[model samples]
Target: MKIQILTHTYTLTIEVETQETILEIKRKVEYYLGVPISSQTLSVCDWELLDGLDLDDYPIVTEGTKIDLTINNHIPAIEIRRQIHITVKFSSRKHNIEVDKTETVGSLKEKIHIIDGTPIKQMTLWFLGVEMDEDFRKLSDYGVDEYSEIIVFLKTTSRMVAEPPSRKLRFVVQTSSALLDSTCIPLEMKDSSTVYELRELLLVRKLLPIDDYIFIHKQRIMRENCSLRWHGVENDDYLYIFKGTVSRG
Candidate 1:
């Protein structure tokens, strides 16, 4: 079967036996591409590839059941080694690591990629996860860890990324000194009590604009119609408040 193994900026394909398992296919591709198995991953949906189902359940690899694979192994090319400095943000902690001159962005991601099993390509990594911007490519685009603190987005979950991060952040005016203009609000509160309930005791004195908006979290973004009352808002989260009228259509 024809398969697409995609990395940050490259995609390669190879024909394989229909009996191959995901883990098995992963190893072969890693070997063929000179990438490390430690850094690569395979993605198959429960319905399409039946992610959790056994390989035997997949039947035989057919002609065009295309499975898109994102190969994350970034290996520094065969070249002289040089210490390149870079600032990497993992969770809430940011660290400066000096890597070889040949390191790829795929390599950098593994160091900070969540162990909970979320693939690097699926995660939206950022400078504080928001604020000023520039979309960052793996080491191929920019050299890192020079000397000073140069902020960058380690990963983008979006493709077609035709452009990098925009210099201006979309801002919405808020009535209080509390709610971030960047924070997202629920679309239609179940009731006035819903809004009051969502805002914590710390936000008791503050009054939200009572606008319909979506609550975007690290894991999920709740629509305005749903309850945002303690669905999970973290301090690390930087919300984007919608300025326009809410729409469900």
Candidate 2:
């Protein structure tokens, strides 16, 4: 079958056998692309391909199938790297590190792990109040310059306790726009809270202008009357507040 592999900045097409495993296909692509298989994430039609799975198993894996490849980490293209100082804030304590601008956020997190013994998976990094969830993105993407500060928040698992009758869902609300500064706000509401109710709260609280702004999660605009539970919004989930239109008289 003919398959296409797409990366952040490149696209490659290759022919593969139906009997070949996904790992084998990845190796072939890696040979041509020079990107390590370990860093590559393959998805076909938004469904992730497992290394152990055979290509023929999925009915969608036919000729001319387009597979999306995402690199989990960034690889520097330049040989000579310049170091810059950066500060990471974890609760009350702040840790500083010297990093190269070309290095990936994952690499920075690894350095932080060495310093504080915190596992990279449990730590979340934020720049300018926006969560740096995409480890593949370089520090420069967030406009990190010399002496830039990144907020570090550690995720903790709750100890087992008596189950409550009903649990409220807590999610993060943040603003994003070229015209406004980024801001993160924590919100707690019942599982049955609808988007309309949240909008009303934002209107009353004056956190965001209701008529001018809209809520977005995972790039999808939230609709009124849809419950938070319907969107699968869980604890610490981020919702972006974006300006819907420019106010022009």
Candidate 3:
């Protein structure tokens, strides 16, 4: 089984047998991280794990279990700084960023833009499954701690047309497959069209199997349930259609 060990600044995945004891797991973590087992406090969710207990006997220690390991030692206030290392997940990509606790959400978004080239206006940050809408709030206000995982979603815009429009905005779709020829087929689509609707249109125009293809915008796979307006898909935006399974790294 795969166990994910999360620390203050890093996340480590380890494979262990079902019969392994909690102490054994601690030893393995110590060997891999160079931290003493005595100094580490391991827990599944919020419940602490006893070192003598066998992992198989624990109902919570199943496959893909996430174990949180915190150091029991205390640091001096004068030497310790109020900063944190967090993982920001954007689509299939994950970026580790070190930020000060006093920094606002808007400032963090700007920092992410500098690193990944994603526009600040289009970025939406979420922590612990809750959206961070108050841009002026400090990171500490949201209870953000070290090694927290923040999800980033990009919003795209659609082109504006004059009143009594005869057609929709044109988009250029390209295929990632090398075997197929790339075509600059101008697809006229409404800004209100859902991603699934666009996928159906691609099936007819690109002549590719519907199930085998996924639409990607700005390197992120567009969710089928959302419309172009939700994604901020603007006029002349490049959408890459890939054949096969999409990798979420």
Candidate 4:
């Protein structure tokens, strides 16, 4: 099957086999783009790919899946955190780590991704048997504290329940005056689609240039990992687009 490699400035199509390792694909990228394999990081839905793993290890990666490519430009990517200890249990294994209570669940997932090669999209965190469904909410908001035991479940087809039927949502993408000359693009998509997917669709269709973007709905910033329905977006709703990322406070 073919997959797309998305860089900050361009997208490349690469045919891949299910049995192929991520490191092998990185070598191909190195040959095609002249970027060293050591400098490239491939991810799908913010899940970092492990060099030792093959495509089959990641069920989310499929035909036409878009993988994000991030280049290490010798910049320090680590951030200082006010630490609190926590235990993340996944199946039969457990990992103890330090995290900031002020960070969001999404950030926590990223930290888990760094520790283990699990994809952020595949993880479902729980505390006190209640699922942490809101990625934008802080750990403290979920009542997570020092030495909290966070349960982790991997999302798989077998573990999934019957999904709700997808509904078509027609809406307008209103760009800022500095972007697209204040153009309003009409779009139709499924309610199940995420804001990040919508942004990828725009970039793939050349409706928007390759760059980081933020979407806002009804004055509230949209979460990339969340669906339109989760944001209370409806048909004919106007989604405002801006040319930057959100600053998590």
Candidate 5:
């Protein structure tokens, strides 16, 4: 089963087997978070998971369960400054960038700008097929694990130009594992269509059950009022569908 490891600053998902020991899980956590196994404490609902026990021994541990991680020791400032290298792929070239896990998307753009001379305003970053549109959000918030490849697309200078009235774009809509058994629904829509219109189209076609759904394009929660083109959705792009609304507050 897959589970989530939640720390104070970030969250990550990992696949685990029922027969795996807790200590083994800690090692995997160490690989991901750089937190030493000796200083890591994992818990579910405040119940500490002991090292020797297998996941089978814990009845509450199951699929999609969130395990809270606490660092028992203070890491040295030098260790805290350790940066993971990620690949930034542009249209013509790809470069490696050293970045802290806590670095924000906006800061990453600045780094790219310094190295490649691309204007920060002209850059749009994509990770795991999702757009990292929120400037202030940390890279971890977008599930940007170590060595993740970020695709950078440069925007044209025609920002003020109006979009065509009607242009067809073919894309895929992927549902969460909990929804539609993680089905990939192929869709073709006008570029001018808003996300709300996409939802209505799904409902009209009986492709999705009537529910409050949130659309995510390139990992960014899509605005219902905004058109697909405005969201930087390209042909053959994949959009994710989740079952809840985002609360800004």
Candidate 6:
């Protein structure tokens, strides 16, 4: 019963009961956009209505419904997403980020700002093939597997005169869970990884003492294998990591 609202400006997601009327939905929309229900105009299922219609009518709107509202000329659209993987590129570097597809593009921009170490105001996300006038679909909707290529371009113009002109680049994103794990896990094990894979796995989850040596099951692993599988550890395996100081016994 999930539906998306593609308006002639902004997109939003909302939940509703089966028995609710359009007026009830309008109240919710009013709360979201800070617009009065009396002033709000609603269109469901691509049909333009002069007056509001009950959600319980011929077209049953359910949870995850995308509601569109227009303030002026800008048209905004919303869609329910199962999973979204977007690749962002800027400043000669590329990053792939994944989120629950239900997340809004506006919110996703905030995350890109953190990962790219840039301010949110400076970033704008644009889908190449996706029209600004069309409803945006989640990554899962397009069968974009873990390796599917979705290019995202980033541009920023700083107020500083010394800064260079903004630019664009390409990045690929996928919907695979394993890809996500591999992508992120490498960062945690990159340092001296050849000798401490297993240790990092469990140790990263804990606060190790600065001056203490770390090991597993009495096995000191500083110069040993860092490969997780080398310690007979599978991707899903769990092991305990302990921190201890060298004692003159």
Top candidate on TM-score is 5
For candidate 1, the C-alpha RMSD (Å) to the true structure equals 19.2
Clashes of each: 14, 0, 5, 0, 3, 9
TM-scores, in order shown? Answer: 0.25, 0.32, 0.34, 0.38, 0.41, 0.27
Candidates 1 and 6, the one with greater TM-score: 6
Model 6's TM-score against the true structure: 0.27
What candidate 5 gets wrong by more than 4 Å, as runs, is 1-164
Model 5 error, position 129 (Å): 34
Arrange candidates by TM-score, highest first: which order?
5, 4, 3, 2, 6, 1
Off by over 4 Å in 4: 1-161
| All-Cα superposition RMSD per candidate | 19.2, 18.1, 15.8, 15.5, 12.3, 21.8
Report the backbone clash tally of model 6: 9
Better of 1 and 3 by TM-score: 3
lDDT, model 6, position 5: 40
lDDT per residue as tens, model 6, 1-249: 334444433354343455656776665544433345566666655554343456667353455555554443232222121234556656577888655454344334445654666754445444446522112344345444443344445444643223222222111111112112312222223221333443443346543323233333212122243333222222323232222221211
lDDT of model number 1:
0.40
Q: Which stretches of candidate 6 lie over 4 Å from their true place?
A: 49-53, 60-249
Candidate 3 local lDDT, 155-193, one digit each (tens):
656522222222366788775433257755567788767
Clashes of 4: 0
lDDT of each: 0.40, 0.70, 0.69, 0.78, 0.78, 0.40
Please give, for residues 155-188, the per-residue lDDT of candidate 1 as tens digits.
5544423322213122222221223533433232
Cα deviation in Å at residue 202, candidate 4? Answer: 0.5
